[model samples]
Target: MSMSRTWPVWARTMVSRGIYSRPRTSQERLRRAVEGKTVLITGASQGIGRATASRLAAAGAQVVLTARNESNLRELEEEIRAAGGEAAAYPVDLSQPELIDEMVDKVLAKHAKVDILVNNAGHSIRRSIDLCYDRYHDFHRMTAVNYLGPVKLTLRLLPVMRAAGAGKIVNVSTFAIRTPPFPRWGGYHASKAAFDVWLRAIGPEIRADGVRICSVYMGMVDTAMTAHTPSLHRLPTLTVADAAGIVCDGAAGNRRALGPWWCAPLEAGSVFVGRPLDAVFSRLYQRSSDTDAARRAIL
Candidate 1:
């Protein structure tokens, strides 16, 4: 089952179900999620980013958020703070390679330590490789933000997390990297795949340090990033709030791989049935009504 569907609806919506709506007078219950801990989230101004920030705030974490737009970040910061959740906004263009380390340093210096880091900033392109000719830099730009920048930032932050004796990390990835792969998403898909590879390879070593890492393989959500894509593409897609809940909950408790998870079963089945079997199944699945409509149309 997908991460979003892995449990009963009550478990998934437990955080939002007026269960905590009564507002607590005691600091004990309100303190578990965030209370005093510091959290850093990239792309915190909108969509999954904004939703994630809101989720963390609801949980009580002091959040440090950054993105390309200063105004948007400030606005989101205000909204979160208004809710009695501590938040700070930092503006950084993640595509600009130099800024990643600088941003990491800025957060490190001010916070002394970051308890959790969520790499959620990424851009997606719906253009074909042909259009990307001489536009290989397009791939570079996406990779710089989606793969390298996040990797570099995570690397720079690792020592502090390790020394602190515990930490959590979440990488926001798209489900497009899986079956019915979008036709023009070669660069975006490949870049995200690269980051997933890098994280999984070193995951064990980090786990050895008591630091947990998870890759959130997300499906379509209503975000500005996916605005151009057809609505049908988002079939069964979670809302941004729903998506953020998965990431926040996973990061909050050290769960591995928050996901929309349409891909997991295929991969699991592929293991026993083999890649060829999976490929045939994918072709058949693509022809089925249950296949994600948007992916099929685009691909």
Candidate 2:
């Protein structure tokens, strides 16, 4: 059974409400901000991306959904249209750079301009470094999907957005990037950090052109992506709807960054006591066993 299903209703509700704060953007606010805009969302077939697409389409945005799952994308497109919302589905494997280019070209050809771009698709792995020595493909695949794919997609759409003189690029990043690095997540963290830093570095140059960027540092959410890791089952998690709301907040707001309330303090603490945090994590690693998913993979 999935981790979330095992939890009692009250426990799940309490954990969701207490640990994961609610998103501030309301349906009315989202409608006011996005009505009549064309928003292209990556990974729109499932999880947070799927929920975000539905919410935006309901708010009057013409949503273009893209993901590897063709059937799911088409189903979502039809569902949105049935609900009286505009939607289009373009399925492509984001890990491939050429495919990303082709997908972007087609989208532009059809819509002329994409006003908002949501980089929400991602892949996650939690194997230890020892297990990864013979599995270098792990890092390569992670970088391909988590870093290069988004970069390629963004680069293609950025020129168009800049030419239009007003655009929003919301990157759905992880809150783990804000905290001290944890064991077994080095590859995932590094790949995500690469894109986060790359975007921020170029933000100043793009701001003058009216291309605004916001990084929504998301916390762990109950989704297919996290389902395999049994270690995370008991931990607090945001629901897909909650996460979608936060992403919409990133889309409608002017803030350069948004995350859980504790992200800032954790980031600050990491900066001030990096060594101590490292030591603590190291000890935790010593006491912990490999995640169930990792163990099954090894067998």
Candidate achieving the largest TM-score:
2
Of candidate 2, the 10-residue stretch with the lowest lDDT total is 290-299
lDDT of 2 by residue, 1-299 (tens): 76676888677766775665568899999999999999999999999999999999999999999999999999999999999999999999989999998898899999999999999999888888887788888889889988999999989999999999999999999989988888988989999998999989889999999999999988889898888777787787887888999999999999999887888887777778999888999998988878777866642
Per residue, candidate 1 scores C-alpha lDDT tens digits across 130-241 of 4455576777888988898888888888899999988888888876565444445677898999998898888898887878898877766657776555533423345566
- Give the distance in Å from residue 76's predicted Cα in candidate 2 to where it truly belongs: 0.4
Off by over 4 Å in 1: 1-31, 178-180, 231-234, 270-299
Number of clashing pairs per prediction, in order: 3, 0
Angstrom error at residue 1, model 1: 30
Query: Measured by TM-score, how close is model 1 to the native structure?
Result: 0.79
TM-score of each: 0.79, 0.95
